[model samples]
Target: MKKFRKIGVAAVGVLTLTALVSGCGTANTTNSTPSSSAPVPTGNAGTTGKLEIFSWWTGVASSKALKALIHVFNEKYPHVQVINEAVAGGAGSNAHAVLASRMTNNNPPGTFQVHAGNGSLYSWVQAGDLDSLNNLYQSQGWLNKYPKSLLNLITFNGNIYAVPVDMQRANVLWYNPSIFKKYNLTPPTTFSQFFQDAKVLKAHGITPLALANHGNWETTLLFSDVLLGTVGYTDYNKLLHGQMSWNSPGVVQAANTFTKMMQYTNSDASALHWQQADQLVANGQAAMNVMGDWAQGYFKTTLNLTPGKDFGWAPTPGTQGVFSVVSDVFALPSKLSASQKAVALNFLKVLGSAEGQKVFNPLKGTFSPRLDANPSDYDAYSQAAMKSYQKDQLTLCIGQGAVNPGFTTAFENAMAIFVTNHNTKQFIQSIENAAQTNPLS
Candidate 1:
């Protein structure tokens, strides 16, 4: 784990160098035990102060959902001015660079959104830049509120560092219903079926898969889905944890499958971001897209398309029984003053509460991290997703910080090259090289 610290520092240093060289354009890169339930101190509620939150969810659905959550928080703590310092970028690419700079300069935000996994939390913990929420969890009774499996991912060295607000299934295959019907195609449940549908769609002049490689992380995300679908959840987890070799036959097969899938994507994929790729599907230019469930929000809210009617969804091929988890959480930085800590913890309390989750997840196109969130509040897609989540084997989304940030970036770089070259051997070797530098062991 100490190696993870070096990886974090080195990655931040690289970002600093890039910013210095390139003039800092929207740069892209990519805790604790708690006590029993207790009353939160509100002596400072009358004091007026600002709470700055940093995140990359500046899109319509995410931004709207966040604002709703903030509105609820503001109602209770009216004196505290909540400043949303959201950076616009796909998968925290730009926001991360800004955060790294802020942390490096000793000017961290009150609390910022982070992935609830080893990749994100471990790096900060290793750097000694984050405070634990063990006591907070104990006080809030959240130890038992969330799933033990989920709690395990956020917990490190017996401390809970962040409060998970929502969970997004990353292995979702979303498609235009009209497009599928026009071609007489059913939603694919197997890779063979996917290839078959892709052939049909291509012959009819439709892009089989909508992919965006502009952010680089989108490509890695697509690869993660393909890898999971090809290798299955167990081996995929093994690969992510370094228990399985990157050069293994399963990984090689997954890489080959990824290459094959890339063939069906739009030629302009490299020019677009994830949202643009999704638009290809939404507007009926493409047949399908593999993305997190957040696309559901974009379709419903931004595009005004109804789920199960305008669009449809299914688990990615060979992943019907698996749930690829990408949870969004908020963590407190260690540099907060006593007053800031109190306000930050209060904000986290709302974020972790069932009330806050119910208000946020439905609008965000995701399910709540809390097990007890009412299913009636969500839409048809989220309701089905929540049901699947209850029974499916859960796996971490490596592209979304389930591993290590340095390794994630390395894998994304390899994927970026693979997208253009389609060189399987080089892709596999690049992954192996990345694993060597940041061993999961």
Candidate 2:
């Protein structure tokens, strides 16, 4: 998917058109938000068959969410068995690769979890390796609930591709509440103030930003947040679209800001995955971690801490308000039995249905994509995300969301080298060199 705000108009236009072709052409904008206004649950048809589901989810809460959805799917199809095939490691490389291999071997799962957007999963769907969910989507009236902005990401060539399971609000700052109390520091609302607070925390021997750059993508998070905060969304998009060169002053500034964060982070951040870094904050070894809502699930399932009392959530303090997102979506794989296809489509509908979103998204510690879904009882940090989303002011991560997988890596690689070496000049050149030129009409 092209991250909405990342690439400039050219890339954005290309992606938007690509989506219109793949996810479905123009999405209708007259839909109402899926709030409490939804109709009372009425009986939907049930199935009595079996289908296998596969995803890269390995966390307890992740599994719980998937299982809950499966349970609901079973309520309709009591005899239908939803088999789960999940494995860990390599940031979904292993699971995705296995699924790709399976596709060739003729044993692909009925449905598979994937990242949202036309840039990532569109190829497989376009290859006729996945089933079109357009018929099912329209039959169930999902368009009226999910909205064109959200649903359009899954729509392609006038056909919908997948059901989004969860939306991760990226670039959030989760701070330890107690640590703030100890230092008498309130979470600052601006980047400048935030940095000042970080200096204070550093004086007292605290790592202000929970950073682990091992997977390398973690560094991309910091760069994305900085670019969004400093350069403004327009230039950030241009940078990703290759309209603006990496040698621009904005990239230079964002890189410097990232270097400042490194100074305040744990020295071991180089070896940490985002999870391990979050653990540092949960365990009080660190004061903050800038990540997405998924970390909220990690804290709940792994550390078992209360959100508001233990930690406070804040967005990457940049302009008045801006948002960043990453969503977990599932596409129907090709080569499904008729019943399996039915099950897959039915499962997707359930995923977006009011109940499916409520049970699954909350458990996953993510916000529901359905517009009207309330994040009732969500911990403090997550509600902060809702505030951002509702404002429609969030910016998407440029490199990851705007660039394709191949190009996304090029950006990540440039960021990793920059973060480690703290080299502004070299980093700017690297990004300029790595960005793939894409022109739009």
Best by lDDT: 1
Top candidate, metric TM-score: 1
Give a tens-digit lDDT track for model 2, residues 133-232.
6656556765555545556656654566678777787777888999999999877777788889999988888888789877777778777887888898
lDDT comparing candidate 2 with the true structure: 0.69
Model 2 segments more than 4 A misplaced: 1-49, 399-402, 437-441
Worst 10 residues of 1 by lDDT: 1-10
lDDT of 1 at 43: 68
Candidate 1 stretches with Cα past 4 Å from truth are 1-47
Model 1 / residue 212 / CA error / Å: 1.0
lDDT of 2 at 45: 30
Tens-place lDDT per residue, model 1, 255-369, is 8888888889889988897888889998889999998998988898888988899989999898888888889999888887767877888888889999999998888888896
Give the TM-score (vs. native) of candidate 2: 0.85
Model 1 residue 116 lDDT score: 72
| Candidate 2 lDDT for residue 40 | 19
